[model samples]
Target: MLEEEYQKRRVLPRHLRKQTEPERPFSYEIRPATLEDIPDIREIYNYYVRNSVVTFDEKAWSHKRWREKFEHLQKLGLPFLVAVAPTGQVLGYALVSPWASKSAYRYTVENSVYLGQAATGKGLGRALLEALIEASEQIGLRQLVAVISDKGAEASIALHEKLGFEEVGRMGKVGYKFDRWLGTIYLQKQLNPRKKPGILKRMLGAGASEE
Candidate 1:
């Protein structure tokens, strides 16, 4: 469907329709991402880059770029997770990134979740999201944000809202794809609120970490 059609109807076309029930029960596991998973992760991401407005990236990222991105996430101690099916295939992945560079925003993180074409509506995205939420909370993050494309993103928006995210903001015509203007929506979920620690307390703890 055209991006304009989606905007007009507020419904994903039948081809993009999500699964209402699993074809069969299959066990999957979510765990910290490994370097070995980069190729599969890149494949899934590049699919969206090429075919959908779900991402604003016009070109697929190079493998080197992906490697650097993953390494950076590792250095920040942020979580990168992969969902593996019973057959050992990667079903999907999720990760967090800095919302901004300033130290004052240290407790806030931007989240990304992607599922392989085969994995949607089977609850894999939900599983990855739940795991990410728990992991982020345990690591001291106080807020999680999702910046999602407004086109071809009904399922994504619904999923975040179901997970307690509130639509905090929207930016219209911020992107162009398929020869049409696209928009962006921001959703935020507050985890646990806490007072910022003083400098002396931060110096004595691992409180300087960004994740």
Candidate 2:
């Protein structure tokens, strides 16, 4: 009789079997990242590095490394944003870096978004990416690219697609991590044209005029 009851429960429709209280809503605020947020951001990224193939980095980064990256992005005048809970906890971060060092690629950037383990699957990634796109556009960036690991990152691919990022290319078996081969999927999004000069262009113009 017990065996028969177990089988019956297993065959029942998912919704008809049982129900529990829905999860309470989560709240967070997105804003520009400050130096104080570096430790939390580094921790969030290192978790994936140590445990998952989402990032190809095999070693965890130190505080000094994160601080250097933060300062570099500040010098480049790029957007580095963070999501914070009302209780003042950093939940996630997103940022854009120069796509290429060439002067011709100044209008393009590569975007990265990482959320805390507890912050996943709550629509937080979507919010962070959207904010990054808007911020990049405001800074006169014309193109944004995302390089995502092809395996174990279906949700990331889907999120980028839903946000209008097109799959432009793929490179297979380029990265090896966790004792297995991994690949990358390249996604690109074109932003609206800017009406005025961006920070980089204005700075260059100032230097030229001074000379």
Candidate 3:
């Protein structure tokens, strides 16, 4: 019996013979962005800035710039979210900022989503953007716009279209970067209308009632 068992073990696949533990699945959580996540987010964005034409900006954003943007979004009560691995790495981020500076465009916002080089192709972008959309709806945003590069951003354009953003317009040679002229494709999504009064309106109503 012992000789037979040894022969069986010898013929078994090496991996099967070792009784190894199964690898933990790749998983992450989508959550509201915090101040601590800014550095990781900056790194992700700068990677694209340096390596691709996905963004028209030719220079990397400084930490100060990122912080300023973060604060600005917070002041506007907009959605800025992150996808974090179980190891606490920021895998990607999605955010919305006012589409235009004027009050008339308050309900409309432009959206941006970016993932780390190693974090792409794993559906993190979709999750982050979906979460951003849900959060924007919850906060009474009416529209979200995505400006994608006409070059080297087919995946981004496809992802936005898959999430219900329609092709609204396109501009050619509007941006010059990396010693070449690049264009933008504009995609817009109309969010679900708000069902309740916005915070400002609610506050005003409460004040009137108190008086």
Candidate 4:
């Protein structure tokens, strides 16, 4: 099968994760983040970057640049979330930043979700995103985007579709790694007026690091 075709066929349950589900009451909390969250966030992100196609960076990042990424997120009013276990282990995180810098594209944002090796499939991703959406929609973002790597086309794509993002676009050959061409999948969802982003929502991130 063609790579894109093969991925479109994969789905992650076709059901969105909800608060009252049996997986309810997980011991983690998702909150906005800052510079202190970088090392743990790097550990979560690098795990996937090294072993999987979840991110398309051509090389592993150094500490300085990694810290810079999160810093940029903070300035954009994006919620760089950390899903923390009761003991304060950083399980995973999700963040969204400007899809484009020009004012015309201000309402659009692309996102990233990364989890530690031990945290996959335990519903931490869902929790992190649930919190992310609540935080982002409060500011004024009209839409949210997930740029899925071609190799992970199944799980992440499926999850986004179930969460209401439609497959709006894709770009081929823009990413090269592991001796192959990888594509980018763009998914989006509209926000209700009642859920529009608010100023206070940005403040929610200020206290994100908690024990």
In order, candidate lDDTs are 0.85, 0.89, 0.85, 0.73
Q: Pick the candidate with the highest TM-score.
A: 3
The sequence of per-residue lDDT tens digits that candidate 3 reaches over residues 1-211 is 6998989877967776768699788799999899999999999999999999999888999999999889877766778999999999999999987776545566778999999987889888888899899998887878899999999999999999999999999999999988899999999999985544264243222212332
Best by lDDT: 2
Candidate 2 residue 91 Cα shift, in angstroms, is 0.7
What's the best-to-worst order under TM-score? 3, 2, 1, 4
lDDT of 1 by residue, 1-211 (tens): 9999879799768899896975667678899998888888999999999999999999898888889988877767777999998787888999988787656776788999999998888888888999999888777778899999998999999999999999999999999988999999999999863333231133223334434
**Local lDDT at 165 for model 2:** 100
Candidate 3, residue 79: lDDT? 85
What is the RMSD of candidate 1?
Answer: 12.8
Q: Rank the candidates by lDDT, best first.
A: 2, 3, 1, 4
What stretches of model 1 exceed 4 Å from their correct place? 1-24, 193-211
Query: Candidate 2 at 97: error in angstroms?
Result: 0.6
Roughly what TM-score does model 1 have, to 2 decimal places?
0.80
